[model samples]
Target: MTPTNILSVEAYFDLICPWCLIGKRHLETALGLLARERPDVTVHVEWRSYPLIPATPPDGIPYRDFYVARLGSPQAVAVRQAQVCHAAREAGLTLALDRIETFPNTLLAHRLVRFVRRQSGAEATAALIDNLFTRYFIRAQNIGDGQVLSDALAECGVDMPGASGTPVRHDLDWLPPLNGPDDLPPRTGLGVPHFVFNGTHSVSGSRPPAALLEAMQRALARAKQIATRTAA
Candidate 1:
């Protein structure tokens, strides 16, 4: 596995997952560090869709109530929110959890991501993903809504389909199915924000930028070693 100048990062995530957003920010920071420290390496990130709450209605359910039920009590939900807020702040993000009113089914959102990725590229798709996160978590907008998704696409400079005027399509043959926790090697528990580096190394959860940077370095080194061995 001779290391090439290009390094690929595959991130499996769900749109509504709070920790995924934080992990994305940390990964961006790590990439910035890599740019400064390893100028020779070009990093590419591919976002994989994983719907965390596939059963939620497209219209969504009361956000607060959903959390209260999931966490077993209102107080528990509040405690979890506080913990998430603190973690988000460390990642330089402000999660407006109170503003959110709905917990939406993310199937449409994931399909929209695949549509954007096909129409444009990874950079544009990433921009749309970021916007989706902001809309859902920060702006409290329902991303599962067709109109909301159309507006988001426009914001990302992507044109909506003429007849439908919405990006939501039932056909997701192009986008690969979400990987089960067992699919990836070296498991670290089932969770979003799973970052697979160079197809050989992986880091789970919202790791700090420093830790992510170290993982990237290790992946790069391993790739180089493999390439060297192959060449010989």
Candidate 2:
């Protein structure tokens, strides 16, 4: 049976950040395990936009050059991203850190995700987000281009129209929620991949699948108690 109470998780991340990819994979693993153990926990995930380097241009920039000029050199950025790749791999994800070509402007991608969220469900949007990250990071594809995004959306069942049509520009928005350098709630002080259990409890970061399962179980129990009390 479908759980009456839905668990909502707001993920604030940018495609350029490799940790974000790791976080997503861990979350998916947690959800899959939960589905097997407790079939009643309904999860609804929302993708929020968070730019790692907002000053970067929309046209796109060579990732190595951009990082080297800001930090040190191409080798240094590679070393850092390599750590992220290792972490992701440990969490059962494959990431190609060395082949990253450019850090494309992801504002448009975020807009496309939001548009899909409005039309499709949260699960579909999450899948699309995963695909975009993989294409850019692993396959070294130019996801900054609108044509690529449009095609990806269509492949994910979005049915987007032309490049400049409504489907492409519908969810393009400038503002994002929880405005700040850190993405979290007002009181919880959490981070990205904030798993909100029935709008109350939350777990941040790339957590273990077991921990996520436990959280879902607790949330389900609490929801049942609330319903029982209401009926009484």
* Candidate 2 residue-wise lDDT, 4-101, digit = tens: 45666666677777677877777788789887776666677767766655566877998678778876877877787777777877987777756777
Model 1: lDDT equals 0.83
> What are the per-model C-alpha RMSD values against the true structure?
4.0, 4.6
- Worst lDDT 10-window in candidate 1: 180-189
Cα misplacement distance, residue 225 of candidate 1 (Å): 0.7
lDDT of each: 0.83, 0.70
**What lDDT score is found at residue 48 in candidate 1?**
82
Model 2 has an lDDT value of: 0.70
TM-score versus the correct structure, for each prediction: 0.88, 0.77
